[model samples]
Target: MSARFVQQLPHRRERVADWFARPGAVTRLTPGAAPLTPRAAAADLAAGETVFAMPVGLSWRARHDPAAFIPGRRFADEVVNAPWRALTGWRHVHELADSRGPGGAGTVVVDRIRARVPAAALHGLFAFRHTTLAGDLAAADRLAGVLGIGAGVGREPGERLPRLTIAVTGASGTVGTALVALLGTAGHEVIRLVRGAAAGPGERRWDPEAPAADLLEGVDALVHLAGAPIAGRFTEAHLAAVRDSRVGPTRRLAEAVAAAGTPVVVSASAVGYYGADRGGEILDEDAAAGPRTEALAGIVADWEDAWAPARAAGARVALLRTGLVLAGGGGLLPPLAGLTRACLGGRLGSGRQWFPWIALDDLVDLYHRAALDPALAGPVNAVAPGGVDNAAFTRTLAEVLRRPVGPPVPAAGPALLLGRRGAAELALADQPAVPARLVSMGHVFRHPGLAGALRHELLRPAPERG
Candidate 1:
């Protein structure tokens, strides 16, 4: 027995080939999987071409032996995972239509997948997501616009499923609130893990310091975002507060997970673990954690290590090294907003050090990506790929807000007032984490660069009265 699905697209025969022939063109979408970016299989396109792919849980190679082509009409590709299993196979079929309607413009699609799963269970698994067959077709549309092969962007239809239950600590915090919205939009049941009495509907409170395992029962995943603010002065006691806020709760949660045997666990870490090294080395996932880091870095190190119990108990662990977020509501945004409104905003310190950061929207995307991605079970930097330095960041931001950059704020002044901790974060410290793991896994970034990201996340257009 076979399943047949057809997508009707109105595009020129030449348009179909053009879309596939271009760079960054992804031919098909697989359900519960990322899009498959197909470059030409030829020299041009030759026989027996091997392409690299990191799909979902595995980073593997797919060797394509083009079996057929119809010039401007359609083409065929037979692919399989080489050196892994003879079982995995895929045939991608692309077709075009006449551009008679919609102003003589049209749609070219590369989709229609047929796979022969090696085993019965494998077949059933793929068969389940075979329902989400539109992704490949949709990527064909996006690939068209990216290379100017097509004028407009294409979007795949949305999927509606029952929400995946999610438990969040610090649901009242800015990032947590954003996470709720993001996860909620992605159809997840959000349960807030509050401290004491947030005692509302859909909330669970637990005291990590008390060491009772009530919170560990029946929850799928855990995101510990509750920690003392890294703002104000970093006194010895303040440092202890930051340490206790993260480490104590994290340790307790991990112990509970180990005892209860709950499966998925994700906790937050920081790029600060890399420490403040001004050397222009773009760190990747393989980069070892350097020893001589700062106090904040030490705290991050401890927080991540505290998850050992959960890891030992067989729960997948994710340590999110989140970057400075540029959002509207809370965080570093409020002060920047105030400055933008006053037109006195300027770059901090020397402004040459890089600031690896993500937009609030992108950060939310990271949470979703992190949760669904099972293979990602270690430290992953959640910063933008094309991160900007402080100086360029300020200028672009000012340009976006239609404001002017004033005289640069120096480190000494902030140290005198905001103290050493504030100075280190705001003025001196800089990191450019490349999000290497994400790119390798084929996660498309909506805001790749700084200016565009700020425009999308922060510099929203004023609302019209009409």
Candidate 2:
């Protein structure tokens, strides 16, 4: 089969092509909803080949056609080895051209592909690619504007922003992975702070308990994201693991940042700081923390306080009080998506509890902004503006998947699995949080509404025309 897709992106042709040629462009453009995971690839398309791990332990390898690589015009790649290559051949060509329509000063992206994959299957993939490209370009532009840099929207010839060297912990985690790629593609240098010995020029050894005083030397900013997963039974051991991983380590890192005099710090926090059961109350950054009795509430309070040393040293610190992050590849979405696909999706508990959530991309963008924008300080509520109830979220997911909702999952079900408090604080939390600070700062969410966000991350295709 052969297909061609074109989109008029509101960006200069050179800028769009430059984005595609950047280090993390492939990682950024790969569809999250796809089953295949990228195993290894060249830093940039011009470098060489890309490999993806497929199901059943198979691999898909594609080589970039160097002869066809035109710096700001076109590039092509072909699948040389894959489980399905014997059945069909595959080649894709990407072209960027100046928009021709009257008053149109943007780039027109053209994608042409030939493969045995069905047109119906290819449609959604390409549609997702185009949409992702557009969103990423917009995000880059916004970041430039936020930082008072050039190279976005309106720019003079050869004008660009100077890149910063950012240090990040938890670089392999979902959020960190996305944020690193976003930063790399946007022309910033990212240093992954590994717990073990440094791996490459892009990494540094970090002992969380007692980080070296010079660990953050020459780093423009630091994003702290290392913490234990909090999705298990809320036993004493599990709770201790979560708290111990965060509170002490965060303080140690904060001290290191203070000593190093890193100008900015963005640390991970949680919405649970406000108590899991603040029903109907719209909490913002200014709201008081929940009582210390609640496990997460207390832990989060301590976690944010850990940044005191850095803040006291005059470093601008922003605590990310994140909500449930929605994405196809990881986080809360995968299991729910699986159950929903199996016709087992339903509301948890009372169904009236507010679900404060944010798209994975939006969360990454917020981190990007927080790292650069000196004006962004203190606690920032990282969530979508449109908070939905559990029932509404269930309905939207089912509607997007075109599946019927199964029977409601009783409160007892989660309690049995995660224990009563775990279920209560996590699965059944009712905090109606909003991004009041983000809104006040004129932050723009790429996906604000739950339905639209779900559709984009889930790769829901456009409606068919009869």
Highest TM-score: give the candidate number. Answer: 2
Query: Candidate 2 deviates by what RMSD?
Result: 2.0
* RMSD list, candidates in order: 18.8, 2.0
What's the CA error at residue 237 for candidate 1, in Å? 1.7
Q: Which lDDT tens digits does candidate 1 get at residues 165-222? A: 7788877776776666546434466788888875665687778687566775677777
Candidate 1 runs further than 4 Å off: 1-162, 290-293, 462-466
Clashing pairs in 2: none
Per-candidate total of colliding backbone pairs: 6, 0
Displacement of residue 361 (Cα, Å) in model 1 is 1.4
Candidate closest to the true structure, highest lDDT: 2
